[model samples]
Every structure is written in structure tokens, then in C-alpha cells.
Target: MGIENILSVAPDLVDEVARLKSIEECKILKEKIFMNQLTKAEQEVFALAIDGHSVSEIQGIPHKEEFTIKNQKRSILKKLNTPSMTEAVQQFQNLHQEPSQKLIRTS
Candidate 1:
């Protein structure tokens, strides 16, 4: 994706935040955001990546260490099929921002 696409999505995210409807909806979004794209650990790294974290900084996310974090980063990029950290972040954002992908909770 290009910078233009990223900018276009920012407004949509803002709309989403401003329009919190229900906890069920939130849960659905989380389920969909992760889906098959990442494991919980990789999802954590993706969050840190979005926050502009360094490899060392990502490693130090409370319970995580350098080796595990580094490994997760590589895994996330591979799953995202992105060649760089920046591209991974962008793809992550794109995947999560779309409400159409929301997952249904089953009993």
C-alpha cells in the first residue's frame, strides 16, 4: 500500500474509535484482526511495531525478551508477506481496519 492509502484509512479508524458500539463488537473486531494472520505473541509485536518500537524496545515489552521478540517479528513479517517492518505495520493496519472482516462469536 502507498502513503495515500494509509492516509485514507486514518479517518476510518478515527470513526471507529469514536463509534464504540458494544463489547461484543469489540471482541469480534479483535477476533477478526488476528484471525489467521498472527499468533497472540505476533499480535503483541505488531502492536508494538505500530507504536514505532525498535527491535530492542519490542523485546522489552514487559514479559518478552530479545530473542523471542526478534523471532516473533520475523514470523509476523513472513505471515504478512511483507519485506520490511514498515510494510508489515501498514498491512496489519489495513487488515484490522476493515469492519467487514468482523468475526462472529459462537456458543
Candidate 2:
């Protein structure tokens, strides 16, 4: 039987399954990030950029020079194999959204 059939027998299983799936997805995403060879600093920069932070804003957050932040962003793009910050953000969003979309569709 499929998960939906099993879920109908025990409605309480829904939340637990969703939680476990979320954890598993997080682990997989971390593995992907590690495989991309980004330094911790570069990862932070990538996240900030994904959140729509500008180079100047990212610089202010890290108290770094604008040039340094720009370089970091460029490095993040290279490591993630993305052409630009916008594409990188889209890629990240797509990665994270897949599990949620699956859950929604199943529900």
C-alpha cells in the first residue's frame, strides 16, 4: 500500500512523516552544499544573497569591504555552478522547495 493508504489508517502519522522527511531533506541539502566546496564564509554569503541582500548590505553585515563581499559572492556562484546570484537563489529555492511541494501534492 502507498503512504496515503497507510496515512488514512493513522492520521497522526502525517506530522511525524513530514517532520522526518524535512530532516532527511535538510541532510541531503547539507551534503550537496559540502560537495560544492564552499567555505563556511562563502556559504553565509550565498545565503545572504539568496535572501536578497545587496553587496553593500552583505558588506555591512560582515563588516567587510564591498570588494571582499563581491569576491565572496562571485566565488559562491562559481562553487554552486550558478551563472549569477539570481540564478543561484533560484537554484537554492528549488532545492528546498521540492520536498514541500511533494508533501503538498500528496496531501
Candidate 3:
């Protein structure tokens, strides 16, 4: 069946699907931003970090020296304007989150 047919049968499902698609699109855009802003090595380091890998674990990879990985992580933080890796990960997570899902802080 076509989307129109599906929408007619379940409007709420259509909305939810659209919302999910939008979230995916936003994530893609954010990823593209990272690609544009970071070098290939930095991207690799950042990806490992995002996957919960420690610097030592990243350094354990073949041909990936400890100093190189640490430098790449520092570059990532500088490029992202984040003070630490944890905050950089949080920023990435926030960028991937849907608008409605983000918490609204108030005084």
C-alpha cells in the first residue's frame, strides 16, 4: 500500500514515522557537520569515543599510537568547542535528540 493508504488507516503512525524520519535527517546533518569540521583521523577518534571506547582502547588499535589518539581527541574537543570528551559526547547526543525530547531548563 501507498503512504496515503497507510496514513488513512493510521494517522498517528504516520506522524510518528515522520517524526522519526526527521530525527534521522537531523542526525545525518549533524554527522555531515562533523565530517566537514574534523579531519579523518579526528573523526575516527570521535567515533570511537562516541561508541564508549576509552583512549587506551583506541590506542590499542593497530598503528594507532597513544599520543596520536590523545592528540586527535584533543583536536576533536577543540573543534567542537567542548571542554571535555564527556561534554563533547553529550553535545553530540543532544544534537541527535528530537526537539520534544530535549529538556527545558528554567530558573
Candidate 4:
């Protein structure tokens, strides 16, 4: 269920996760989509969703209307190739395993 377990079971996913590095370049984003076939917009909207925004809140920050925000979310789900936003974001978060100092580790 943990990230290390995922990496062990599927190292390719780990390699895929490295694209999230802060030091990564914009060109890499293009490569990830054009070459690797990963969903770029899904990743962005996924991050926004993780930050706890309602569709209206998301629209506010992005300066888009609610319907547009909803459309973007739909597009994001399609690109991520998931049935829903929750599933896509959850899998992306689980797979990427963003390092957070604010988090407490019990293990």
C-alpha cells in the first residue's frame, strides 16, 4: 500500500514519478506528455484538488467560471485516464509520494 512497495512492485512507476521533481524543467513536461503519454493538466488540477478547493474556489483562483472549472476537471480526468477526479488524484499522490516536512511519520 506504501510508495516503496509500489516502487518495488513497479519500478517504472517510480521512474514516472521523478517527473514531479521541483528541479524539473518545463520541456520535460512536454516530453512526459508527448513521449511518455502522461497527463500534464491532470497533474496540475490534481495538485489544486489536493489543496482542498471547491469547484468555485478553483475557478476563483484560476479566474475561470465554475462551468469552465468543471470542464477542466473533466479534461483532467480524461488525460489522467481515470474514471473520476478522486481516483486520479489519489493514485497520482500515492505514486508520486510528495515529500512533506509537515507530515508525521509513524513507521
Candidate 5:
């Protein structure tokens, strides 16, 4: 329907639609910010860290030396704005939380 027709039929719906559009825009901005903050290598390191891999194990991977892996870990922490490994893992996990999983809690 045209804007004028929609406005005449339901003015309140226009406001709601605008609000939902704003929310979706914010989500897209946040995702872009997160992606821009991390380098490709840092993202790989972050994923491995989330998997509970040790530094040595990461170093064992092709093209990843100990120094490079350690540097990537530091960069990941910096990009995620987290101080510790635990917090970094938690932050990454939180970003990927499923809608259903968000409703569940463990005591």
C-alpha cells in the first residue's frame, strides 16, 4: 500500500514500523562494528579460543606460530574490549546466543 493510504488506514502502525526499522538498523550497525574491529586472523584465534584450544595447539596449526597465535590472542582481547580469556569467551558466546537458548538458564 502507498504511504498515504497506510497512514490513513493506521497511523499508529507507521510509528511501530518506524520503531522496528530503527531497531533493525541498530542491530546491523552493531554487527558491522564488531566485524570491523576484528581482523581475519584475530577472528580465527577467537574461534579457537572459544573451542578451549591451548596456545600450543593453535600454534600447531599450519601458518600459525606461537608468537603469531599469542599476538592474535592479544588482538582479540583488545578488539573485544575484554580483559581476560574467560570474559572474551563469554562475550563471543553471548554474541552468538540463539533466541531459544537465551531463555534457558542453568543454576
Candidate 6:
């Protein structure tokens, strides 16, 4: 049986499964970040972007010129192999979501 089927039969194990899944996702994200070899600035821009910050908002917080921030965002997208910021953010969110949350999304 699938994990979802098993989890459905035993709701009490849901929290433990979600917690372990979260830990595994964190490790996966860390590995991907490291493998991408993003520079510090690129990493910072990426984090801000995924956190829902617009370029203008990021500029004010990072004290960077808009042009520079835009460039870094572009670099981040390229490194992540995402076509756009929206896609990158979606992928990031999917990676961090709990198993139950993912099921809810599909439904």
C-alpha cells in the first residue's frame, strides 16, 4: 500500500511522518543549494525571492541597486533551472510542504 493509504488508516502517525519528511526536505534543499554553487549574493536574492519579496522590496532591504538585484535574481533562476521566479517559488514551496499539505494541493 502507498504511504497515503497507510497514513489514512493511522492518523496518529501523521505528525511523526510530517516531521521526518520536513527534515528530509531540508537536507535535500541544502544539498541542492550547495550543488548549485550560488554565490552569497545570489543565495540571498534567491531566499528573498522565495519569501515573496519583489525586486523593489528586496532592493530597499538589501540596500542594493535595483539593477543589481534583478541581475542576481536572473542568475538565481538560471542556476535553479527555473524559467521564472514564479516557477522557482512554486517548486520551493512544493519541496517544503508537508505530505498532507501536498495531498490537499492536488485535491
Best by TM-score: 3
Highest lDDT: give the candidate number.
Answer: 3
For each candidate in the order shown, give its overall lDDT on alpha carbons: 0.72, 0.74, 0.78, 0.57, 0.70, 0.72
Judged by TM-score relative to the true structure, which candidate is superior, 2 or 3?
A: 3
Candidate 1 lDDT by residue in tens digits, 1-107: 99999999999877665555443476566557554578987877877788888777777778777788888888987887888888877765665565542443322
lDDT by residue for model 6 over 1-107, one digit each (tens)? 99888878786577667766767766576557553667888878878877788767888864688888878888878877888878877777765553544433321
Per-residue error (Å), model 4, residue 42? 5.5
Ranking by TM-score: 3, 2, 6, 1, 5, 4
- Candidate 4 backbone clash number: 0
**Candidate 4 per-residue lDDT over residues 4-100, each given as its tens digit:** 8876878666544554342244334433543234355545555687776565567776555677667778877776678976776575555334333
The CA lDDT at 7 in model 1 is 100
Per-residue lDDT of 1-107 in model 5, one digit per residue for the tens?
89888768696777667665665565565555666688888878767877898767778889778888888888888877889767877865665452332333322
Higher-lDDT candidate of 2 and 3: 3
TM-scores across all candidates?
0.54, 0.60, 0.69, 0.44, 0.53, 0.55
- Report how far residue 3 has shifted in candidate 2, in Å: 22
Residue 36 displacement in candidate 2 (angstroms): 5.6
For model 3, the superposed segments whose C-alpha errors exceed 4 Å read 1-20, 98-107
User: By lDDT, highest first, what's the ranking?
Assistant: 3, 2, 6, 1, 5, 4
Tens digits of lDDT, candidate 3, 1-107: 99888768797777677776766676787668766788988888888888998777888989888888888888888999999888887887777664633333212
Q: Least accurate stretch of 10 residues (summed lDDT) in model 3?
A: 98-107
Select the stronger candidate by lDDT from 3 and 6. 3
